[model samples]
Target: MTRAEGRPLRADAQRNRDKILSAAVRVFAEDGLSAHLERIAKEAGVGSGTLYRNFPTREVLIEAAYRNELAKLCDAAPQLLESMPPKQALRAWMGHFIDYATAKLGMAEALRALVESGVDPYVRSKEMMLDALASLLEAGAQAGTIRADISATDMFAALTGIALASGKPEQREQAERLLDLTLDGLRTSPR
Candidate 1:
């Protein structure tokens, strides 16, 4: 439903695209590259034509799905902060990050294959993640609930370490404990 150059997508078209991307993420994560586009269309409640129109190729769909998930995770930062104290917001956001990480692991093999085919599926991932971390940290620091010296990069590394170390269901408890420890370390001393 896009028009000539510089025109915005029609609302229905945008909705269809969003649906397709969301469905693609779940399908790809669950089934990897073996997931069929027709199945994705069914999951999205859209026609195959709509899915094809939005994403012409498998690589394009995979890349778009991964980017869409990243955007959803990163976009949660401000919404969480708005509804809760910054410390709580950061903690909540961490949980969302964990979920994102889990889905990401499922999609990793497919994304790697996409990269092997010369399509980088994560062009803006690092920057987007860093920005999300920075926002959460900044909110917490401004509220005097978190230390100011922590770098977003360092925090992201810590989260990634925790996720990788305890990503398994059997190690979920330990992972939670580690995440709590990391969160505890972010607190500033009461002045």
Candidate 2:
């Protein structure tokens, strides 16, 4: 199928792959690693063979689906900042982070097994998240909306704590208030 050494996917193949990834995310989110390949293919409207062609194993599919979801989250920071104030953008990203955490908790078992298999699906996760946070924090600092003194490491820890704490079902409201408080702490008060 290669028109050249690194040629792009044929249109239909690309479409099928996208469909499979989308279905994999939802199915995994709903049913975790036990979700079957046939069910995923059915949800994607593709054949099991097509799904296997795109992703030969469940681990590969899960890894791809996870990375895709992560890219979507990390990629949103700049777009959100572009369309809104940096402060609002940062807050919105926290919401995204919470969603990510919730999904992560659901996928925890599968991800752990993936780790045991010597494949680190999260190797670049912290770096990517830190980069996104740095970008937003830099913009907010330049705008004098957020404090410039906050370290990226510190911010990441805070966000991670907030995400884990608020990512639970019964504690979602508390998470919102905690997030607001956390954002307030980042704001530079008038001198």
RMSD to the hidden true structure, all candidates = 2.6, 2.9
Clashes of each: 0, 0
Provide the overall lDDT of each model, using Cα atoms, as 2-decimal numbers.
0.87, 0.85
Report the C-alpha lDDT of model 1 over 70-183, residue by residue, as the tens digit. Answer: 888999999998999999999988887877787788788789999999998788898999999999999999999999999999999999998888875567788778888889
Worst 10 residues of 2 by lDDT: 1-10
Candidate 2, residues 1-191, lDDT tens digits: the string is 23236898899998888889888877877787688889999999999999998899999988887787788779999999989999899999988887777777767777777888888999899899989999999999999999999877898899789877777656778888988889989989953
Model 1 residue 68 CA deviation (Å) reads 0.5
Instruction: Provide the lDDT at 17 for model 2.
Output: 84
Residue 136 shift from truth in candidate 1, angstroms = 1.1
